[model samples]
Target: MDYQNSLAFAQEQDRQDPLHHFRERFYFPQVNKQDAIYFCGNSLGLQPKSAQMYIDNEMYKWANLAVEGHFKGEEPWVTYHELLAGGAARVVGAKESEVVIMNQLTVNLHLMLVSFYRPQGKRFKIMVEGGAFPSDQYALETQTKFHGYNPDEAIIEIFPREGEHTLRTEDILQSIQEHGEELALVMMGGINYYTGQVFDMEAITKAGHEVGALVGFDLAHAAGNVLLRLHDWDVDFAVWCTYKYLNSGPGGTSGVFVHERFGKDPSVLRFAGWWGHNAKERFLMEKGFKPMEGAPGWQVSNGQILPMAVHRASLELFDQAGMENLRQKSERLTGYLEYLIDAVPVGKDVIEMITPRDPQARGCQLSLLVKRNARQLFDKLMESGIIVDYREPNVIRVAPTPLYNSYEEVYRFSEILHECLEGC
Candidate 1:
């Protein structure tokens, strides 16, 4: 995995890559009809070439058949979301019945909280990691407030110990112990969005369940980037958006997972709609709402075939390449990026990688903590056509996605980043 600055080495890796054929399936961004170095999948994924056809087929079916397209056309629009279930289940490691494709990320998180975050007397606190996504923070604060509880008293935030840039596993477990008695839910991102640190979900779920609390994860960053076994890990619930590594285009439809243990539990509360009613009797015009058994019970609206079709195209690619194979390539690709970044003489002085050294502790993203002239450095990289994302304070996130990013892209990015630093 030694990344030398040469076209032959990159072409050699490309020739040997089993997943290399996948690059042709996507519509890469262009500068004079040549594909740009696309390393920002952590923000928005490249569009699949077939994505337009997927939507067009649906549009044609609708135009030709009108309302009858729901049940008449090929891959009927009626149950279109169901087409994504098996691939979704496989990606997240859950039972087919345990997964459902529906609303966006924050909406699904709120719905999951309604069912899983039922707090009792004294056991009302929800645990989350510090520096969580602003949307998650707002949702948790509102959820606590909706339940007649104050966020300051009912929400527990975990931060890293002194001199540490990330939260340690023992620190997280110890914090769980301190609030175990009063904890009602332990919900956090599967991977930290800013720091790119993957949390220990299996251990955290075990600890949370031991304390009589429900556990869940916001897998927005980890879903397609890392291997997840939500059911095997005994996670109570989880949610994710597909626009990142899943490559489902911008603001694509999101998904959810509920472990089979909650399959037949009628005690769980949910905000239900007509879309979640039993399909067999759905058109009977029944007055009472009878929700589906598993994660589908949480859907609050009808499926929009447009965005969901984009997700279907992306999932097909994931199914073809397999997540295990993706992770195998991802570690080496991101590892090479890290190695080259660290190899620069002044790389460590002007920029610091906040991501963990262990590959298992992160995905493809490496967040750089810049000391001075942060925005200027980021702008220079961008002007040179290295497309990475900049967080508010002082971090620039560079994600070399496995499906489409090449080792050459990583090497090129590192060289440009080094030049940017030298100029600064």
Candidate 2:
């Protein structure tokens, strides 16, 4: 695909895009009262227009139906979260039984660690990336500490070689093998939050299994952005948030993926909760915890109805559009963003792209390692109504999402970036 840096070319592409109609379904934020060129979906997705309606419907059930709402209404509050399981499974490429719409990402991570991160005598070390999101780093650290092990000694951090911004697959796989018998678990983000590099989950899962280790991932950045085959990859478990690419709402419900091997086997250990008990005997309120058949068995509490309502609305759009179709558009949209950025005058002197150039190695994000006047340039971009976000120190994370972002918006963003660069 030869991309031209022109509004006309962008408009032509948008016109031919099969998913173009989806752009109209979302409500973009106002930049000086105009619809801003929103490129922050990687951080927070634009709200779908139908979100309010979904919330209203639930609120009505809560108001009128009261105690009976759990069993009454078109979508019963008791089983509401179940509505999202099928769509959620499709987003991450897993079986329906293997997926659970449950607690927040970190909470679910803790639940999974309780069940899977059993550090035995000789094999007690966990492998993770050097600079994972603070939440994940904290979760793993505390989990290790709770098990009475020193984090520094019990954790192995895999880092990029000098002068490299992204990780090498060979290096990661070799690191797992080098730890061999010492490695108890392999936990990492499916995509690096800062670098926007998508890890080879399948390869990593296989390598970890070869070394006698259970593997899991925080798909906070990968869930709706990249193509995942968690079940086929034979991944042990995974957790992700619905607020980002899934476009559910701020602090939205999160999802978990548990392979059937662990999901069905009641012998596997987990922190028991009432909601995780079998639905048939739920009202019985018995002493013994009889866990459900699969991933639902991990549920700690009942559904967050309002948040899950928003999630249901967003997921319907995902199911209608499909992940394969979304990924198809995402590659080209993100590529166009990179192509334009690369064509910026002075290139590496002004900014260095840290994200992997290969489309398959990334999703919709392009992390710009700004070199000169980083804050000034970022401020200029914001003042010019381009809604991109800036990280601490130097990087500015820009994302052009496929479901709602347009090629014309991408072209216009490049033009504004040129203007901001001039000020810098």
After superposing all C-alphas onto the true structure, candidate 1 shows an RMSD in angstroms of 1.3
The alpha-carbon lDDT assigned to residue 275 of candidate 2 equals 86
lDDT per residue (tens digit) for residues 4-86 in model 1: 65557766887888988888888887754567788899999899898998899889988899999888956887788889999
Model 1 misplaced regions, further than 4 Å: 1-8
Worst 10 residues of 1 by lDDT: 1-10
Candidate 2 TM-score versus the reference: 0.99
| Model 2: colliding residue pairs | none
Off by over 4 Å in 2: 346-348
What's the true lDDT of residue 82 in model 2? 81
* lDDT for each residue of candidate 2 in 82-186, tens digit (9 for 90 to 100): 888899999998999999898798999999999989999989999999999999999999999999999999999999999999999999999999998999999
Worst 10 residues of 2 by lDDT: 340-349
lDDT value, candidate 1, whole model: 0.90
Q: Provide the overall lDDT of each model, using Cα atoms, as 2-decimal numbers.
A: 0.90, 0.93
Best candidate, TM-score: 2
